[model samples]
Target: MMTKYKINCLIVFISILFLHSGQKPCFAQKDGDDIVIGKYSIIHSSILDEDRLLYIHLPRDYEDTQLSYPVLYLLYVDIYNYFADATITTEKLGGTGEIPPVIIIGVANTNRYRDLLPAKIRGRNEGGGADNFLRFFEEELIPHIDKFYRTKNFRMLVGPQAGAVFSLYALITKPELFNAVLSENPFMNPENADFLYPRAEQFFKNKESLKNFLYIKCERNERPQNLEFAEKLSKLLESEKPEGFRFKAEFKEPSGYFIPPIPFGEGLRMLFAEHKLPENFHTNSVKDVISYYEALSEEYAFEVDAPSHMLTFEGDKLSQQGKTKEAIELFEFQLSLYPKSLNALMRLGEIYRRMGELQKARQYYKTFLTIRDTDVAMIHNRLNMVERMISSSAACRIEQEIRKNGIQAGLRKYQMMRSDPNNELYFDESEFNAMGYRLMGAGKTDDAIEIFKLNVKLYPESANVYDSLAEAYMNSGDTENAIINYRKSLELNPDNNNAKEMLKKLKKK
Candidate 1:
């Protein structure tokens, strides 16, 4: 039997072959329309005293959802379309969830030599502007992109040759700026090598942990000097062996100065190897997996949720194994982390409906409708069936009472109607929150405010209830009440960033 690594390599090889074979040949391509792969934007760089062009490739679902993604900044993009293509394709075909979607930003260069070299050599006139370039990149380019995009704090920088030298410089000087560095065929001449080796030694000498991924690749036969330099650098990094820093070096066959697609793909795979969920992972181990990645997120200073698809897959497996409660918990956790996930809502709706909980099913189905616009016939049929079931259910009558009278009065009536000890009246926090939102959407601000206030009274310990009440008050133009409720919500749940931002905005007003 092949090892898992070999199996994965085979799959990637096949995928690359399939992609290449499926695409139109280079010479046979027709130019009827512009073959646009990404968008172009210009940023005025105050550090460089000039404007720079930024080429950005957003993921396919970027505009459809409010999900934040990691960013990949590629240097020397003018000659590296293959690298961009590989990255994009790998992300698109995220087979085992190893490759998460990323926003690719290719920094087009105006003066490659000047931007890549760290310092001026004896005879080089077009170099020595690397410091200025890095300043422009760190201060102007990155900030502008981050402000305009829904981006995670995670960043990766990829470069080749002299650009790779620049990437190494950044790794030694500003390790916090990027979470990963992919250096391909670094032109580590004596001058560049001497400058960088000292910094690397000093950086590691401090006994500080460097929590990042570094992948360096060089062709053995391309240039003897650069290859030797790459080997020495790799050994030095291994010797220091900073904790939490993952280092990998590959000496490939001669491929000239270009970074071959195979190494590029492998580098990315190595960088995100821990991102994929194991095939044997079950519901019991889900928490452990989440905890592991959560620790990684803390170490890397970014928010990293388990891939939604992997969670859904595991939830389905658990549900198939007659583990309904576990499946429900898994889906609920997924929704808690990614509230905008339509799949999680749909799964919860299906699970509740299968379990004969019509009210909960209807609630989740309705929530799914609010988030997704896809008109699946099966979902429509299930939603219709759920609505019909709810109309004839006893819970419907209690909700009607709540709408007609008030929450307290409705609860009193419900208790009187169901006098048995086991037949208790149940009204969850989410149900009330949903009802309040519906009323708010219908322009009944006063009624919505009442409902939300009642929810807050019923579930005072729930931070979400307070957040809902705060939102309702904010919508009603009651800034004081909104600020107070938002503050209360934030006090209860300090991680409620939405509440904190709303409070800030209301206070500014």
Candidate 2:
């Protein structure tokens, strides 16, 4: 997603997080639980002559995969006021794949005025310490975060209110550091206005292009001074914004602080709007898709693949036209690129099942179930259906054993099939997980718990298995056991917000 930063040059303001709690926070923790979203970390800064607190939120797959991600630096953390908003937004966007997953580093302010507010009027000498803060960002803090955590070169810096002015200042002074600057409602005085055009002239006047994004939005509610500044800055960017320097001003919608946190999501979306696959890019030809993404990679300076949906959409069209073989080819190509892509896996499974290739269909379905990586709720039952045709297969055979005798007898048959060297039966973690859920749905909590326990034993490293066990335990009213399994799930996958919430709820009991 290539979002041009929304730099609202004068509609400046500070925000508080208790905004979401629907009441004033007497203290920080909600419901006696500590911070819900991200954790607290400290970095001692020599340039700022103090220790800085940082709120860091990692993507869900960070611990699971060796993939590096872009960083979103949210300024004025001030104990997670904007930090929570930013993390929540990114998590949703990332989950839906509207935007790629990113590591969010919310730099909490020890002294908000000293660090964020760069310019000072006649009376204020306390401000204007932004230079040292930028140095800390450039020299000390950025390097520290980079060294300790996995981060891509692509970085975004977000600043709200006074912080926005400082972020815009960073754009002019250290444009090389960030790919985008979302300066939200900056306080632009005459000094800032005077400080802008000439500096833009000096820096961007000679360059062929900047290839950076700057988005600004001015607040409204009878602030004539801010409105005046927004107009002047809009004109300045129009004249001086270098080629490829993406810039946009003014909101098409009313942005009154009904917790106008919508702009936060809006600015992010604008910056990376290009990250999404366009309809024109969707074609039946895999070669065309590759070419499009390759060009996009060159533009973003990062490798971007055709989204699974794009490939699947084209594949679906092929299948609808009775070109099953071609659809299979396209889906195979997609699977090779995105090995864990559920769309590709499920499409192939459906195609293979229709062609009477049940073994291949089962294999793809098994893999998809193991991933269970989806935000969409409707597909869960469909994915676990296992067999589309009623056959005397091993899956049905095991179910017969369970009904005739019990879970132990079913396991005996499964083990016999699994242990044979030339076994026709299929055994998989996903298969067991699905069976467990089916048992749970049938009100067989005991059988479900036993089956889930077997899955935990077979795939001990699988966080999803532990999550299943925890849920089964919870359903059986075993709070102590549920808490135990949920803790293990969370330990394995820190991005398990469900496990975290469940643990919090159970602990309060």
Candidate 3:
């Protein structure tokens, strides 16, 4: 039995092998295209106040078409070319209705710690340089790209780890700089929350209009702090609901970690298709796309291939190029070809849902459930009243129980609940509050605060409530409030480790 970790590593290795082999000529093998892949230099005055070197890989078809494609800007702090193969693969497949094509711009760092850090601080190597570095992008680099290339108005940015910190800053400060951004595995900690939350709040309040797609994929090995930060950022993005602001968060538990690159790659391709030149470069009829996918499935049935996801990958790119109808057709075709494919079915349903075809979406979801009865918890939740009405009374009762007691419990509890409709059910808020404590135990003070707030609202009299909230607040730099809450919590319980520590910390502050 191949474990999930082994599969993830195998995929990563194969992807690297694929890139170096270059059997696929989607990367810059052609000439006379401004979307070239090479190093360029710019004077960095604003953030670093020094000269900066960067690399960019332009799309293959960029030169031939007068239209401009959105650029995916990346900061290669430590890792390099993680997505180069997938980027090219997506673009090549997109050209032939397999994925979307977009320019890849890689920004190399002479002093990554300095350029990507949000603050001007000491202790780190060549610290206190981010301001000058960002200045370089605004004053010199972006201007250079616009002048040199026939680019689209849209842009995207990708960063991992330290670079992800910078990406978060860009999202908040320069909200309009990129139409989409990806921040993977940011090394979040105590310091990040102190900075990020205030900035996020300010960003949401000030930047009233933000039409961008933000994708955050936290690795399974990612620090708990980073995971907390990602969760917080995701919730904030969802809550704001800015115009055209779309967001996705993939937890990618150890078993699912390797799957993130697929979505990340797919997202870029989709954004590329949205801004691709001539728009109709990869458009096709529904019949044609269905046939193509059917053939693909036949070719890769025995292998652990991503054939089902491939069509969605293609649809994303097409959608990017303003061929939404074609994109929808392809998604629908993918479902028709592999009615049981979870990825294909979900994508089809999503397309319909986005288009406001709720009935059609529900039908696809129903079909999907018929194929795979397990792991349909979220899909079942998304169904509208009409679609839910089709379920048998017993099924409806089960679903209601599931909604009330979560899918797992509902699975087992359904038998008992079915036998006695009058059985009393109570959701233990203390257990829910304990979940927040567990997060805090893992050093996720910021995320724990969110959970604590909910816990307090639900169980205001719980002695643990004030302690957790005060500790979380103190950790996040709200000293005055921490003091207030510490007193309140201590009033409830004279003995509490959290409240005592928090009070001591606040008093020192």
Q: Among these predicted structures, which one has the highest TM-score?
A: 1
User: What is candidate 3's lDDT per residue for 1-509, written digit by digit as tens?
Assistant: 11111113455556545545744343433464332233344444444545555555555545433445556677772244444543556455544533335566667667676677766444544434555666677777777778877666666778877777777788777876776777778756566556777888767756666666777778667677878788877787777757656777777766444323434565554543422223343545555544543554343221111234456667777777756578877776665545555666776676665543456788877777775655467777666442543343333343345446754554465457446767554334554455455556556666667656755776778787777788778778888877887888888888877777767767876
On TM-score, who's better, 1 or 3?
Answer: 1
Off by over 4 Å in 2: 1-36, 95-97, 189-197, 222-225, 251-254, 258-262, 308-315, 322-341, 372-509
Candidate 2: minimum summed lDDT over ten consecutive residues — where? 1-10
After the best TM-score superposition of candidate 2, give how far the Cα of residue 201 lies from its true spot, in angstroms: 4.1
Q: How far out, in Å, is residue 255 in model 2? A: 3.7
- CA RMSD (A), model 2: 18.6
* Per-residue lDDT of model 1, residues 135-216, tens digit only: 8778888888899999998999888888898898888878888899998888776677777778888887775677889999
Among all candidates shown, the one with the greatest lDDT: 1
Instruction: Give the candidate order by descending lDDT.
Output: 1, 2, 3
Show how many residue pairs clash in every candidate, following the order shown: 0, 19, 16
Assess every candidate by TM-score: 0.65, 0.62, 0.45
The residue-by-residue lDDT of candidate 2 on 275-322, one tens digit each, is 666756545556766787788778877666555556777788888877
